[model samples]
Target: MKHRLVTATLSSITAAGVAVALAACAPTAPDSAGAASSGPSDATLTVGTTTDVVNYNPLIGNSRTDDWITDLMYPRLMTVSNTGAKEAQLATKWGYTSPTQGYYDIRSDMTWSDGTPLTAEDVAWTLNEVKKDKPAGTFYGQLGDFASAKATSKTHVEITLSEPNSSLIDEIGFWGVVVPEHVFSKAGSVATFANDGKDGGWVGAGPYTLSKVQVGQSYTLDRAKNYPLVKGGEPIAAKVVFRVFPDVNTEILALQSGEIDAIGDALPPSQVAKLKSSSGIKVEEAAGLGYSHMVYNLDNPDLAKLQVRQALSHAVDYDAIRSVVLQGQATNDHSSPIMPVLKSYFDSSLKEYSYDPKLAASLLEQAGYTKGANGKFPLNFKLIYSLQDAVTSQWATIVRDDAAKAGITITLSGTDRNTYLAATNAGKYDIYAGNFAIMDDPVTNFTLAYLPGGAINYTHVDDPTLNALIKKASNTTDEKQKISIMQQANKVVYDNVYDNIMYTQNLFFAHSTKWTGFVPMPSDLLSIVNPVSLASASPVKQ
Candidate 1:
């Protein structure tokens, strides 16, 4: 049994190979799930994304820019394998003798892209740096319980927490990205450390190493030959070049013309529909674990009334958005805070709001928000959102029209990405729209958003009971107990306590049929992509 456990690497590699081969052949061959078509063997595949990689930092907004780049350049301590098992990436193995403390055995053979050996001290230093305060620094308070991490040996490390944390394993495995202490140690804080035009700050043990990076044009990655092809290692994609475009329309055109092999994250609904008719352009749709939610500022006495909030929730037409904007590609969320993929933990009893303007007006009227001579609600509120996408603008327009019928007048406001997040975080708006991306567990979502003074909690929710429940869940180690606490906490948040959820939309990416092995990883982290048939792509005729 110990031998079976120790050398599970081959079985892991073989399983990945089979998955890649099967995925590559599945589309062209009959009676199989529609994968992309066959291609001539090649090593380099050019990918198009909306954002460019100016910095190879993993702490960035979990953006596709950061996701695609970091997956190639750096590796985390422990990562979810292709088979969805908790396997070691830099750490050879990890075990917990107690809920508060866990020990990890580091791989002695693993080294950074610069050929420096990966030691436990590097992990310790990076973890410490992540906790320091600076602009856009510090993780959610769920990581607050982390007391200390110390190296026991050259190949072993131990982390001790202030309290029992059940989610520690998943949290460490997810957010605990190891960085080279040798390079980053010079910087006193993360804010002062500059990655500007230099690949020195982020040396990691992933499959590909950063070769060249040009701000808006392209970023190049080459295969890490020295990196082991072990269980949790990134697979070989000889050259992964990400081409950044200005907008989604241009990205779609580039994909159709065969200028790029694949494009992701910025694909629009109309473009996806157009791609359906084009021959040899394969399309894949999956339920993104994220949700595009409408947040109500319950801090306002007018908006604080549960019926008024519920009324506003029922005013907007979800079917219209799902039908007209989403083009029948996305599913209507029936109030599942946890994504459909997390079936075991998701709560189903929460009521969904349908388009019933009359019902909404009545609810508002019953709550004593009677209309004055202006035929509008006795109050005027401001709505704020990200101005980057047409979908957000369109959704805002629909909301404006619906709320007008209920005698509530909302002044729609738009801001740039950075400004939008800052405004929301400062609680400067009455209503907001944004998606929570890259969260795998319910703990991060519920705890961070609704807990008092929590970093992401824009709604200003201040329920002591909710706060206590969240703390209890975070400190508990038993899976069943934690899940029960999570369900109860979600019920408190979603069941007329704090906020409103719009609908969860489907994630769409435009790609040519020649590119094979594109599967939707529900986690927004695109680290584990296996572009196996990249070796078979047609050569650039230039």
Candidate 2:
């Protein structure tokens, strides 16, 4: 009855009317429920972490930690398994509906903790709504491959795109990143949907349901009983609680004091040795599909020159930074914007620019940037970095200091994540230091930084050859052929030093012996709480 009134009254409202209409359904409660008895020993696990879930909607939050909690209940159609294979979870079967259309068969037995049916309508609604939102910048990744979506039946959805898409179903549906249609169909600002702390205010169909939510402080999730994938058993842990800390030190302290059983943030390399020596703490590391790199604002006169860009790339002591920062835990990167973790697409033969301070100086001199009277190039760059990202800040500082050896003058600016991303995407920074959230595939990933006037390409890298290759790669259906073309284009981008990628990241984590059965993932990009990783998590046996 409540849902009927909501559907008839609010779904048809205009964009202007939506804000007022959905504002009432917004009276919220937490997401998910379960009959599983909350136990004592392994029943409750409190995870220490940073960042807060400011919004319940996965598509809108500014906090990096929001997904760590929201994903618990929203559940996806599929996810990348710990073995790196495509693992289906939510959608039982999927295939092409037409040349440019795809269809998914949602699992039938699933339901919200409230017993509301978890249907294909939710999947279709999420895709269609994201398209309607038309978010810019990094948010563009949320909409995935669908141009639009529609549910033909309660259990079937067809997603249509201009071209046959091979990536979206995995990236978007993996781990059930979408929210329930019944919850959001009447939502005005999806961003404010999780504003209340009432029971069942949130809605999801994952293994766990959110039992309580106190944004910025803590979130508690209860294991959904008889979750289909668990073989009619509940998840290993009955309750999972996440608490936020302001920084890494506080998190580490919480673990040591036994106030928390684990942490979600990747522990930086500088602290690994100390944690490794602590009794009862287990450290886990994984190969990364992510990379941290510096991007140039090519609009600037100096960075616009290929020689100048190449020289700056040569200025950083990449190996030294890697050793000091990563403590030999990461793999060396190649020149390509794509991380080497993608076995098929990464062309390891392409040489990265070696750290050659002398060569850096010569290139600058040859480009008519010879050391001026004060012994510095006329270029004065202000590097914008995220204040919360200590590693990126250190990377920026190291580059700033090293560039001086090549007579390059650089100023460092540290701002919060929102400001840093906004400034970089708005083309306000000369150089930006950050990590690239590459997609599951190389072709889609490269478009962010390589396509003609690419959305996030601050470098203004509008190379005709790369643009043509991007088009060529996107047109194909053959896996090997796509790899062949993307690698070729990747080499071209590397040749021009479009962006200086420092290393293929190796994200690390540590947990208490109080819990175990965790199956480590190939990349922390999928994270510990993701379906595949959580499937392997059980209490450490005596």
Candidate 3:
């Protein structure tokens, strides 16, 4: 999963409204003989989410809610399995033809919801258009080295790159959302096209199609009649509805009251235990492929110093935050941008930052910072975080208190998710605290987060040494050599204290026990409501 730039406004949902919404959206009840009386066509699966779907265009929308809805409608060439391996979806097979050339054999059985054949031309056109438009989403960054894509045959598409990139296939195949060329070729500009489907021109090639959208309320999708991914060539649920809530508390309430069959967002760590004890709920846990971190803007004079950044990293109490704030739900190991789950790439030799206010003060003194009459350093900084994130909200105060112990003056700024993202994109904050849903590929992750002019380079790091190492790693085809290069790059990042990785949390998702066949993915964004899982899931007959 990639980062989203905007989040919709929170809609207030009263208890009375929950009852009415559930009555209208709930699935058909099971009857005698362990079967749905009216058959699967009457079945519905309603999911609860905290954010609303603001963008319907898969190529540009980056929010979790946006991905969840668009992914069901727009099919990808490849998808990740439970263990994060690339699996074929719309493409039957894919392989590299040369060091700088790759190809995919598109499946011929797939067709758009409007009865248009999904062919290699559509795949080539979508990739080429994205490269030309350079949209502000996950796909453009991955296409930095792409030259062009051409359809060799009706079922085959070839991609040419300017340089050798071993990770390009996995990154683009799994992350790229292919749209029908017939429908989108008429748009004025791909970057500005909303593709909201307001005119009933929604065309898709996945298991479902966008049928209705009630802004700030719910997004409804109808199952396609000829989806070849499922057992019967169709999804069990005839309709999938995503209902919006103001926050996680309301979502949990809706799940408990049987209003929604599952929650699209990960359960807060503190609420996991109580939800597990409740009947009719099944809690599933997965290894995290992402980590929460705080990035310091290198443009700031104080943060530019090595000792200042090092002192700030050591000032915070990492152990207490993991134990108290995370409730021991996160991994208590060495903190690095590359999570511990990716053992081959994670550098274990790097030393972990220990909490010692005395050491922090000493480092600050060595950096020529003197304390004022108030017994605090002359440094004052503001940290910005999302107010919707429960974990960040609770731990931010702890971070302020801990930094104060080291004679550092700090201010906390919490805002709505949309505002927080907007300010971050505008470089309006001194220190940015946030988390990514998934970073499955270390090479791609490093390029986007640390490389110069990268999409999510919030820290403003411009070290030539780090940039060279990442570039060298990205141009290699050998797996061992790439790992070695990435490990060296990770060391460079750790030594510079470019970012403070807080913890890698084990994500937990809760769904109704009445439903079965839910596939669990690694990231919270794709845990239970992914395309494969939703298509295979059904009401567990009595």
Q: TM-score for every candidate vs. truth?
A: 0.81, 0.84, 0.90
* TM-score of candidate 1 to 2 decimals: 0.81
User: Cα miss at 446, model 2 (Å)?
Assistant: 1.3
Runs with alpha carbons beyond 4 Å of true place in candidate 2: 1-42, 81-85, 136-139, 142-145, 189-200, 211-216, 437-439, 452-460, 531-542
Encode model 2's per-residue lDDT on 382-487: one tens digit a residue. 8888876656766677888899988888899898666776687678988878876334566666666677545567677788888888777765656677778898
Which structure among the candidates has the greatest lDDT? 3
Best by TM-score: 3
User: Positional deviation of 127 in candidate 2, in angstroms?
Assistant: 1.2
Residue 83 lDDT (model 2): 29
Number of clashes found in candidate 3: 0
Query: Tell me, what's the RMSD of every candidate?
Result: 7.1, 9.5, 10.5
List the candidate 1 regions with Cα displacement exceeding 4 Å: 1-44, 52-56, 60-63, 78-88, 133-142, 198-202, 211-213, 229-238, 298-301, 387-390, 414-419, 524-542
Judged by TM-score relative to the true structure, which candidate is superior, 1 or 3? Answer: 3
